[model samples]
Target: MELSNINWMLGAACLLAGIGLGVLGYHLMNAGARNAQMLRQRLAERDRQLAELRDGVGEHFERLGSLAAALNKEVGEATSRLAVEAPHRPDLAAATATMPEPEEAATTSDDVAAPRDYADGNRGTLSEDFGLKQADGDAPQPPRY
Candidate 1:
């Protein structure tokens, strides 16, 4: 009878230990599952924020492109209006005539004073002065070094 009671006590202790271990293991597994779920929620929220940022950037770029196009169109229209308004001015008429688009007038050399002809008549001597002065049909050289 004494041996049987000892055996029963040992069996009860083992059963209690097994039940405690099972409860502890179940709580640990539940905690791990909750942590994984929280991680997944955080990742989803981050993805949503990234998408919103991308959309905002795209909208900003679109607005910038539209603004650039508007500015270019306004500049073109203003230039056209100015050309139409001042059609008879010598410079304006010259610009419109498109005859080899006359090479830019040469800068005056420092050695020569402003021409007397330019003073009397508002037009500067462009090709005529150089043509008369050239020796043997060579291009005229600037007077100053």
Candidate 2:
């Protein structure tokens, strides 16, 4: 009878330990499942926002393309009208017909002033006389060595 009692007690202890471990493992698994579900929800929300942004950008580009096409059509019509009226203006015709010869109007060496000798007191000769032309003033002082 004593040996049977010992065996029964040992079996009860083992069963209780197994039940406690099972409860702990169940709690851990439930926590992990909850975290994974939250992450999945956040990912779905982000994907929806990205889709909306892509659609808005596509619409904006479409509007820009339409505006550009309208502007190009207007420009083409204006250019054609200018071309038709250009030959009727007498002033414009004369200006275009008598373009001046560049060689005949070229500047000669006499038009530009020659280089002056700075060795004498003619340092201010090339400078503009600001109408205070006091040419009979004292001679310039010599440069220091």
Candidate 3:
């Protein structure tokens, strides 16, 4: 009787262990699937957000184009008005007629200073040996502790 009971208990424990292992293995096998589904969801969400951003940018550019068109129309009207009025106004026409001569507009070499590249003579940042440390051969070396 005792032998039979021991055999039955052993069989039950083995069955329970097998069920536990099977459950664990099933979870392990499908782990990648769960992660893949989550990634797909995130990708879809990002795509939706990107579509919304593109739409907003398109609308903003449309608004800007309309404003630029309006501004250009106003500027053209103003220029046309000025052209019609300039012929009647002798003072405005006279000012436009008097253009400065090329010789008068020319600047002498002495008037304009040449561009400088360095801050100082040899110690400037642009010099090749500016940042290098000088070797001290005469100084005694201290012993390291």
Top candidate when judged by TM-score against the true structure: 3
**For model 1, where is the 10-residue window of minimal lDDT?**
101-110
- Higher-TM-score candidate among 2 and 3? 3
RMSD over all Cα atoms, model 2: 10.7
> Model 3, residue 5: what's the lDDT?
100
Please report, in order, the local distance difference test score of every candidate based on alpha carbons: 0.82, 0.83, 0.86
Give the best candidate by lDDT. Answer: 3
What ordering of candidates by lDDT runs from best to worst?
3, 2, 1
Cα lDDT tens digits, model 2, 30-98, are 999999999999999999999999999999999999999999999999999889877654678778779
For model 1, the stretches where C-alpha displacement exceeds 4 angstroms are 1-16, 87-145
lDDT of 3 by residue, 42-137 (tens): 999999999999999999999999999999999999999989887653587678679654663475654787787665556897677675666777
Arrange candidates, best TM-score first. 3, 1, 2
Model 3 residue 9 lDDT score = 97
TM-score of 3: 0.54
lDDT score of residue 15 within candidate 3: 100
- What TM-score do all the candidates reach, one by one? 0.48, 0.47, 0.54
